[model samples]
Target: CQPGFFKASASGEMCEPCPAHTERLGSGALLCPCTDGFYRAPNDPPTGPCSGLPSAPRDLVATTTQLSAGKLLLSWTPPEDTGGRTDITYSVECRRCEGAACQPCGEKIRYEPASAGLTDTKVSVSELDAHLNYTFTVEAHSGVTQFAAQGTPRADRPPSTSALTTSLHYTDPPKVTSMRVDERTSNSLSLSWAVSPRPRAQPRPIRYELTYRKKDDNLDVTMYTVLILEKSSVQINDLAPGTAYLFRVQALSSEGTPGGSSMEDEYETLPEAHLTQNNTAVIFGAAVGGAAMLFIVVVVLLVRKRRRNSHTRQGPEDAYFSSSEQLKPLKTYVDPHTYEDPNTAVLKFASEIHPSHITKQKVIGAGEFGEVYRGILKAPGRKEVAVAIKTLKPGYSEKQRQDFLSEASIMGQFSHQNIIRLEGVVTKFKHAMIVTEYMENGALDKYLRDHDGEMSSFQLVGMLRGIAAGMKYLSDMSYVHRDLAARNILVNNNLECKVSDFGLSRVLEDDPEGTYTTSGGKIPIRWTAPEAIAYRKFTSASDVWSFGIVMWEVMAFGERPYWDMSNHEVMKAINEAFRLPAPMDCPSAVYQLMLQCWLQDRSKRPRFPDIVSLLDKLLRSPDSLKTIADFDPRVSIRLPSTSGSDGSPFRSVSEWLESIKMSQYSENFTCAGVVTMDQVLQMKNEDIKNIGVRLPGHLKRIAYSILGLKDQTSTLSVFAV
Candidate 1:
C-alpha cells in the first residue's frame, strides 16, 4: 500500500497507502500512494512496484541443424526472471519461410508437451512438402503472460524430387517379315526376318517390337514383347511344341508412328511325335517297316541272282544262317549292330555251356528290364562262384527283345569293376541273365546307412577311387553309364564299390560324333544336367554331371539330391544359376570338384579322365579328409526320461530336477566335456543338498558372496518365486 493516504476504497484498485515522506493532502487524490525509494510531487501520479523486466533467454539453440524426415527441431533455456516470478515455460513456433513475415505457423504435424516444468525448448513439424524450406521461432511464457522479446528464427530444408519413377520411355511395335519354326531335334526355334530400308533423307529413329500370343487363348494377352534396334533375327526356346501360336510385330519411330511396311504373320507348331503315344508308335513302326521291306526285296533279288553269282561268291563260310547251324551266335552278335543294314549277313551261335550248369538262387531284385537272382556257376577247374543272373521280363515285345539284345551286346563290350559283366545267356526261354560277381551289400546308400559312421574318409576315398577307375575304364572303352547313381552302385563286404545297371547305359555305336534318338522316360532328373533336362540329349558330359550328384550322395551319407524341392522348382533354381551347397560332411576341395562337374555348359565340364586325375590327387592328400568327426549321428541328445518322478539316469540329481522343471540338462555334466567353474556357482546350496553334492569350501564361500547369501541359509528363498 502506498503511504500517501490511509487504507480506503476497498472496492477500488487505486492505492490508499502513502509514502512515509509524502502524504496525500486531498481526499480526492488522482493517484493513490508513493513508494519510499522515490519522491512524488503533489501533481505527480502514484505508481506501484515496477514489474521486473521479463528476463531474456540466456541460451536458445536448434537441436538439429540439418533437419530431415519432414520436420525441424529446436530447444532453448528458460528466462532468468523465473526466480521472482513463476518459472518460465517455452513455446516453439515454426514458419515455412524466414523472417518476421513468417508469423505464427499452425501445427504442421504434431506438437509434444513437457509434463515436467517447461524448461523444454524442442519442437518439430511434418506434413510439409519434401525439399521445402522452413523456419522456426521460440519464446518464453509465465502463466498467461508472454515475454516481450522473440528469439531469432532458424531455417532448414529437406531433400528435393523425392518420388521414385519406374519406367523408361522408348519407341514402338516391331515388324516381322518371315516366321519359320524348325522341327529339328533341338527344342529351340530360330526366327529371322529382313528389315525394311529407311527413307534416303533421314532414317527416322526407329525401333522394333515383337509380340507373341498363345494360339490356345482367345483373350488379348501377349505372352512376350521385345524391342530390338535394327536386328532382324531372334531365337525362342523353352516352349512346348504342338502349342499353336500367333505372332505380331510393328515398327515405331521417334515421332510415334506405327505400322510402316511391316507385316504380321501367324503359324501353327508341329505336333510333337515324341510326346504323343500313338504318334511315337506310328513313327517307330514306319521306320521299322520301311527298313524291313527294303531288306526283304533285296534278299529276294539276291536269291534269284544266287546261281548267276555262284562262281563270284565261291565261299560256304559266307552262307546264310538258315542253311548253317554254327551261325546262330554270330547272328545274335551281329543283329543289334547290323539290324538296319539290308546287305549285312547275321548268324547266331549256341554257346556250349548248358543252362543246367548255372544254378539259380532266389530272386534278389527287379527293375524295368528284368529280375536279377543269386546263382552258382560251375566253371571248369574253378571253385563254385556266386553270380547275379539278369533275366528278361515276360511281356517284352519282339522289338523290345531286339533292343534288349542290343543293350546286352553293348554291355558285353565293357569289362570293368564299374560295369556289370555278362557271363552267359539262357536263350531257350527267350531270357538272358547277366551273371556278375555277387556283392554282399546291394547298394552304396543302404550300405553306408547300415554301417552308421564307421567308414572313415580314407575308406570312402578308396571306394570313390574304385568308381572313378571303373568309369575311366568304361570311358576308354567308349561306353557311358547314363544311369550313374548311388542306387545303381553295389558294394562288396570289403567296401569296394561297383557301378551296375547297364540297361540304360550305352556304347557309342557311332564314332561318338553322331547323335541317336532315345526312347524317353521320366529321366533321373535329380542327377541330370540342365541341357539333358531341357533337350533330352545325353552325352558323356551329362553322365559326368550325374556322377557328381552321386558323389554328393556318398559324401553326405546318402541324402537325396535336391531334397524337399519339387522337380519344377529344382529346375527353376538351377536355371537361375543356383548350385547345391556341399553336404555338411563334404570337404571343401571335394565340393569344389563336384561343382566343376556341374558346370552349366557341357563343354566346360570336366572329362572323366580329368575327374580321375583330380580324385587321385585328393586321395593322396591325407589332410583333405580333415572334416570334424564330432558330428556323429548316434550321439543324439537324451530327452528327459518320462518314466518316473526320479531324476534321469543320464543326468545328476540337480540336472534331473532341472529337467523335470523344463530347464536344459547336459548328459555330460560330470564328464570333462561339460563341467565348468562358472556353472558350479549358479547352482544353489539347497539344490546341492538335494543332489547330495557340494563344492569345495573356498568355492562355496565365493558362491555365497556372489549370491549375497549367508553361508548358513537353509532354504533358497532368495531365488523362490
Candidate 2:
C-alpha cells in the first residue's frame, strides 16, 4: 500500500486507502493518522481526516529590556492547541503610535532582529522613536510583512495591537553655526562647522549631520545625509567632476529638531579624471593609449569631463546658423573642431521664453528635480499650444538650476516626430522652466496597464514600431539611450509613442567618457545587457537589450519584467543564460525580435535600423503574428531550480507547470484568472491561447497535463481540492 493507504485487517490481501487529510507512513499500519496541523477527536472514526488549522501561540509577552532604551524583547510559550502539528512559523508586526492614531512602523524606522523564518517564540526588537508610542504583535503566519504596511494583502490571521508609551524625551535643538567649506577636490569636499550651545548640557545627547547637493543633479535630486556623531569637520567623497555643489551641516537634537547652517557657496568641483561611459566613443586623430583625445572643438563636446550622465553634447553643430538654429532644423550634419560652452550652446539653440509666456494649469506629474505642470505655451509669433512645463523646485542651488536646463541643450537639437519635442526654455528669469509638448497619455507602461486588453496585438506592434523608429533616429545621430524602458516612453492622445528622458543618454562620440566602474554606472540592471552590466560598456547594443524589455512590458500590458525576482536574482539568471519568457499573446515574430535584442553577443544583436525595418516588415505582413511562438522543454532544461516531477514538493497548477518545465506561464494563468485545479482542468486549446500561452509547445504540454491529471484523479478529487 502507498502512504495514503493502510491495512485494516490482520490478514487482509489488500490495504485500504486513507480518507482526505489523513495518511499512513511505512505501510502495514492498522489505522491511518491525521495530517500535520490537524486533529482527531476521542470518538471520531479511526480513518477520518483532520480538518482543523493550527491555533495561535500561547501567552505572547512583550517587554522593553534594559539592555537598550528602545530595544524590545518578546517571549511566548507553545500553543495550548497546536492542532497536533510541529511545523509552525510566526510573523510579527511593529507599529508606532501617536495617541489613538497609530500607523505601521516602516521597515526603515524599526529594526527587526529576527530572521524571516522565525520558528522561535522569543524575539528581540529594537524599537523606534523617542516621544512616539510603539506596539508589537505576534501571530501564526506563512510569511512575514503581509499587511506589514499599507497596500499589502490582508492576512487570514487577525492582528492584535497592544503597545506602551515611550519614556524617552528631548529638548530644544542645538545651534549649528559658522558652517563653511574648508577644502575641495575633484571628487571630495572637506567641510567644518561650529555648534553653538551644544546639547551635551541636556540629558539627551545631540549629533551633527552633514549633507551636500550638486549644482548639476544626479538622478536623485534630494540631498544625501551623512551622520556625524558630534564631529565638527568631515569629508564628503564620490562627488562628480567639473560640477558645482553646496554643503550644509545640522546639529539635530534627540527631538529631531534641525539646527542647520546656511547653504554654502557654489564652489566649482575640479576636473581630474575622465571616467565616463560613452556609447559613441570615436577616437578621432588621437594617439592610441595616449592623452590626445581631450581636445575641444568650437561646435563639439570633445572634452571628456568625468560626470555621470555628463552635461555634454557631441553634435554636428549648426555653426553657420548660430543665431537662427532654433528657428529651423539644421539641414546638414557637420562636426566642427571646437568646444563651445554648454551654457552658450543652450543660449544658441534652446529658445529662451519669458516666464509670462507660460500659464500653469494643474500639476500633471513630476521629474527627478521638480514638479511638472500641464500648461499653455504662447510664444510671440506662434499659436497657443498646450505644453508640459517643468519648473525648478524652490531653494535650488545655481548648479542644480544649470543641470535642470542642460537637458534642454540636448532636447533642442533633436527634430523628430517620435522624440519628445522641446517647445522652448526659460532660464534667465527667477522661475527656471523647461517646456515641452504635452503628452496626454503620459508614460507608456502606466497607459498600457490602464488600457490593458483594450488594444489588439496589431496596434501594440504599431506602438513598438514607433519606438523603434525613434530609436533608429537617435542611433543614426550617434546618441545612446541607456535607460530605454516602457516608463521612459511617452504617448500622446493620438497613441503616438515618443522616446523621452535623457538622464542616462550618452554621447556617441570620439573617445567616450574614458573612465568607468565595472558596476555599470547608473544603467538599470534588469533592462541592461550582460556586457554593459558587468563591464560598464554602454553601446547601441545595450540600448537594444533595453528595447527588448520594453517590448515585453508592452506585450504583458505593463507587467513587471522578471516578475517579483530581485536584481541579484535577475543578474544571476541572465548570467546563467536565462531570458524572460514570452508574454501571453505576444506575436511569435515580435518575441523572436526580443530574443534577438537580448542576444549574448552585442555584435550579433540587431541594429536599431534593422529593428525598425523588421518592425515595418511585420506591420506590412499581419500573418507573421498568427504563428504564435512556443517554448521547447529542451530549451528550458537550464532554467533555475527546475527538476523532474518524481519528487516534487507541490502538485498544484503552478506546480504542474514547473514539473512540465513551463512555470513562466504561472503569471499568464494568474492574469487570466485561472487559479484553481478546476480552472486548469476546464481549460482547452483555445482557452490556453486566450490566457496568453503563446508557446505552441507550452499549449500542448498544458493540454496534455490537464488530461493526464483529470484521468489520474478520475473525478478531479485527487490533489484537486
The clash count for each model shown is 24, 17
| Candidate 1 segments whose C-alpha is farther than 4 A from its true place | 1-353, 505-519, 627-721
Off by over 4 Å in 2: 1-341, 504-520, 631-721
Best by lDDT: 2
lDDT string, candidate 2, 392-493, tens digits: 899988767766777787677566668999889888888889899999999999998777666768779988998998887776555667778898899997
**C-alpha lDDT of residue 442 in model 2:** 97
> Residue 630, candidate 1: how far off, in angstroms?
15
lDDT score at residue 516, model 1, on the 0-100 scale: 31
| lDDT value, residue 149 of candidate 1 | 21
Give the lDDT of residue 679 in candidate 2. 78
Cα lDDT tens digits for candidate 1, 1-721 = 4334544445566555543434365654545443222233233334332122234555555443111123334455556554234545655545553333544345444343322234654543333433223554455554323211221112221111111111112222334455554442334555666555443335445565555655555332213434454555666676567665555455655533334334445555555664446987889988988999999999999987886677576552233112322211110112235446311211131132357778988998775567778889887776788887767788887655655555555555444445655565555454654556788788897776555445555556667777877776665433556677888789875456887766543332222222233466456667788888788767667888888888877875665566545566567877887666665455667778788888887767777778888887765564776753332111111122234354213224345324222122333245423254345546665644444334342233223332431221321221111
All candidates: TM-score: 0.39, 0.44
